[model samples]
Target: MNSLPPLRQPCPPGTCTCRRDELLEEPGADLRILRLTRHEEQRLLERLENIRSLADLERLQQRMYEQLGIRLSVSPSHNEVRSMRGIVIDFVEQPGLCRKTRQAIPAAIRRGLERQPEIAYRLLDAHDLLRDA
Candidate 1:
């Protein structure tokens, strides 16, 4: 009588049979996408680790910001943001990259936080960009 999650594990004794993750059971774990798989983290984080300089990091940063629907800057460093799902994502970036957010952060943008906590992604209401409110 409802919908199913897009991601999944093998049917025959897979590593995690967690269709109902403990995290999701927590309070405020809205229907937003706040979960990550180890495999995905490995793939994307690999690219992030290859960054050779601040410029490179900035380039990736820009791509992520623009492509991800985040168009607001609320700080000098990539501290964190909360998506419409209400999950707080933390990012670690340069001194002036300026973490961004907008109407609502997409679920896939959690890459910044999943890999190394180096960068976090959270969507904020364009009108309510708070510093962890």
Candidate 2:
């Protein structure tokens, strides 16, 4: 009588093992916190696509700060089995925050995700230094 919904209600076939597998957002949860102009996002994606190594990621991190006033972090994936790694971007400037931004950023929402051996720019959600305060 756990009476709890599955990770994914009506889970997709083959993804759930009746243990702990599938997960999904509620019916109407728009998790996209921040958004960039189409051109800005496209430019970011282009740089992400160029990440061929960790060094590249580091450079991108720097670039994100200088270009877009956003802090970006890249790290190796702990999951050896997975093909890629991860990156974390917090819009704040505290403990885990990035201390630099080359531009004056307007208020907005933002989030960060991870990268692998190759760079893949993925935005889970977004926050900000001022926003969080």
Q: Pick the candidate with the highest TM-score.
A: 2
- The weakest ten consecutive residues by lDDT in model 2 span 102-111
Tens digit per residue, CA lDDT, model 1, 1-133: 7975443222233333333354346765432222223354345346555544434545765765554322323322333434323443344322212122111222233333344333332223333456457
lDDT of each candidate versus the true structure = 0.37, 0.34
**Model 1 misplacement above 4 A:** 1-22, 26-34, 59-133
TM-score of 1: 0.28
lDDT tens per residue, model 2, 9-84:
2325554332212112344432121223444555565556545554555577676666444554433333322422
- Any runs in candidate 2 off by more than 4 Å, and if so which? 1-36, 77-133
**Candidate 1 clashes between residue pairs 3 or more apart in a chain or in different chains:** 83-123, 90-120, 91-119, 91-120, 92-118, 92-119, 112-119
Question: Which candidate ranks first by lDDT, i.e. highest?
Answer: 1
